[model samples]
Target: MISTGEEVLHGDITDTNAAWLSRLFFEQGYALSRRTTVGDQLDGLAREIEHCSLTADIVVVNGGLGPTSDDLTAQAAAMAANTGLELSEHWVAEMEAKYARMGREMPETNLKQALLPQGAEILDNPVGTACGFVMRINRAIVLFTPGVPSEFKIMVQDQVLPYLKALFPSVVSQVCQRLYTFGLSESGISQTLSSLVVPEGVVIGYRSALPFIEVKVFAPQNCPNVSAFYRTIIEMLGDNVVGIGQPMLSEISGLLQENAMTVSVIEEFTGGALVNELHRDEACASLLKDGRFARDFAKTDKDLASLAEAHRRETNADVVLVVGGKRHEAVSVALAGKGAVWVQQVASKRQYSQSSYRTVIATLALDMLRRYLCGMPVFGHYESLSSLSSFSNERRTG
Candidate 1:
C-alpha cells in the first residue's frame, strides 16, 4: 500500500487512513507485505507504486487524488502501469450530472478527475468528484483512491473491498475479538497467559493502550470454540478483566442500565474527570443525577461515608461513588447504596502523569461501583462489610 501526502510526511495531519486500512485488511485475512508512504511529488509516488507492485500481489495507493496541482496519483498510476492517461468520458458525464444536480457548474479543474490510466476500471466515488481507478502493474493489482477521508472510506467499502474479495477467492474469513483488562501490566498479563494451551486455528496478541491491556484473539470463521479461550483468560486474569471490546466507564454504564440503577458522583483528587466520563455516556443522562466536586475533605472514613450519604440523599440516586486521598500517595473509592457502604483504598503502583492518574482514579471508582452493584468481590488491601458501618479511610503501606 502507498500513502501519498505531504501533510502526513510533515506531521501536519495524522495518517489514520493507513492504520484503518491495515486493520481492515488484516481482519479479512489479507497479508499486507509492506506499506509505503510517499510525498505528493510524482517521481516519489510513481517510484513507490512501481516498487510495491513488483514486490507484492496487491497494492493500494491513497491520497494525491484531489483536483489540485499537487494531485498526481492518476499520472503516477499510469507511469507505474507503463501506459498513458486517457480521459474517461463516462466519468466526465457523471461529474457534470452530479454538479448539475447540485445546481452548480462543474469546475474546469475537476475535469482532471476524469483522467485514468489506459485500460483501467473506474471505482465510483458517490460522495465526491475525485474518481478512483484500479489497474495492474507488473504482477500486482494497484488501487488508487482520493485523499479525503470520507471519499476514501466510501470508495474502499463500496468498490475496493468487493473487488479484492472477488479477485482473491481463496482468502479465508477471520474473526477478531478484543478483551480489555485493567490493573495489570501488559507483561504481567502476557506472562500469566503464557502457559495456556493455544487452540488450533487461533492466534492471540496483546496491546497496551495505557491503563488497559487489550487481548486480541483471532480465529477462523468456522471455529466455534473461540469463546472458550476468552473465558479461560478471564478466569486466569480474574478481576483484572474489565469487559470485552469496551472501556471501564462504558461497562459501568451498561451495568447501571441493566440493573435499573442510578448513581451520583463525588470526587476529590480525580477532579471532574469521573463526572465527565459519566456525561460522555448517553445513558448516563438519565442514570447520573448530581455530581459534586469536594476539593477538601477530612481523611476519615466517617467523613467519606457522610459525604456519600449526603450526595445520595441530595441526588436521590440508587448509588453514590466517591474518590479521595492525597495526590501521588494513594486513592480511595467508596460505594454507598442498597443499605450498605463499601470502601476500598489502593495505592499507585507506578508513577503516572497527573492526567493518567486522574483517569486511573476514575476507572477505579467505576470498577468499585460495578463490583458493589453486581455483588462481585472487590479487590483492596482493607475490606469492610457491614449493614451500617463507618469507614476509617487511611492509606496503608503494604
Candidate 2:
C-alpha cells in the first residue's frame, strides 16, 4: 500500500485509511505485506507506486486524488504505468449533473478529477466527487483512491473488494476470534498464554488499545480446533476476559439489559466519563436511572459505600455504583445492591497522565459493576494496580 500526502508524511493527519484497509484485507486473506508513505511530490509518488507494483500482487494507493494542486495521485499513477491521462466525458457529465442538482456550477478544477490513466477501469465513488480507478503497472494491479475517508471506504467496499474477490476466486478467507480483556498488561497477557500451544497454521496476536487489551487468533477458515482453542483461552484468562468479540462496556451494558436492572451512578475524579460510556448504548442509556458528577467526594470506602446506597435508594434503581479518588492517589469503587455493598480500593503502580489516570479509574469502576452483575468477586485483581483494600458490608435498610 502506498499512502501519499504531505499531511500524512508530516503527521499533520492520521492515516486511518491505512489501518482500515489493512484490517479489511487481512480478513479477506490478503494481508498487506508492506506500507509506504510518500509526500505530495509527483516523482516520489510515482516511484513508490512503481516499486510497490513490482513486489505486490495488488497495490492500493491512498490519498492525493483531490482537485487541488497537491492532488497528484492520478497523475503519478499514469506516470508509473508509462501512460498519459485521458479525460472521461462520462464522469464530467455526471459531476455537472450532480452540481446542477445542488444548485451550483461545477468548477473547472474539478475536471482534473475526471481524468484517468489510459486503459484504466473506473471505480465509482457514490459519496464524493473524486472517483477511484484501477490500472495495471507491470506485474501488479494498482488501485488508486481519493483521500477523503468516506469516499475511499465506500469505494473499497462497493467496488475494490468485489473486484478482488472475483479476481482471486480461490483465495481462502481467514478465520479470526477477538477477545477483549482489561486489568492485564500486554506482556503479562502474552506470558500468561505462553504455555498454551497453538495448532499449526494458527497464530495469536495481541493489541493493547489502552485500558483494554485485545487478543486475536488468526487461522485459516479450515483450521481445526479453533473453537476449542478460543474456549480454553477464555477459561485461562477467567474474569479478566471482559468480552469476546466486543469491549467490556458493551458487554456490561448487554448484561444490564438482559437482567432488567437499572443503575444509578455517582462519580468523582473521572468526571462523567463512566456514565457517558454506559449511555452510549441506547438500551443501556434507557436503563440508567440517574447519573451525577461529584466535584468533591470523600475517598474512603465507607463513605463511598454510603453514597452509593443513598443514591440507589433515592433513584430506586436496582444497583448503584460510586467512584471517587484524589489525583495521583488511591481510588475507590463501590457497588450497592439489595443485600450488600462491595467496595474496592486501588492505587496505580506507575504514574500516568491525568486523562489516562481518569480512564483507568473509570475502567476499574465499571469492571466492579460487571463483576457484581455477573455474580463474580467484585474486588478484582489487576497486574498494573495495587489493591489497597477490599471489603463487603451488609446494606442497611430502614
Best by TM-score: 2
Query: Mind giving the per-residue lDDT tens digits that candidate 1 earns over 275-305?
Result: 9988898997578888888776747666777
Q: Judge candidate 1 at residue 87 and give its lDDT.
A: 91
lDDT of 2 by residue, 1-398 (tens): 89989999999999999999998889888889999899999998999998998888999999888899999998999999999999999899888988998999999999999999989998998888888999889999999988889899999989999999999999888898999998999988888899999998788988888799999999889787898999999998988999888888789888998899998888887889888888888887899999998866764678888888888889999999888867458888888988788887888898788889888888888888888788787777788899888888742210
All models: lDDT? 0.81, 0.88
Model 1 score (lDDT): 0.81
Clashes of 1: 2
Give me the runs in candidate 1 sitting further than 4 Å from their true place: 325-328, 380-398
Model 1, residue 53: C-alpha shift (Å): 0.7
Candidate 1, residue 300: the lDDT equals 66
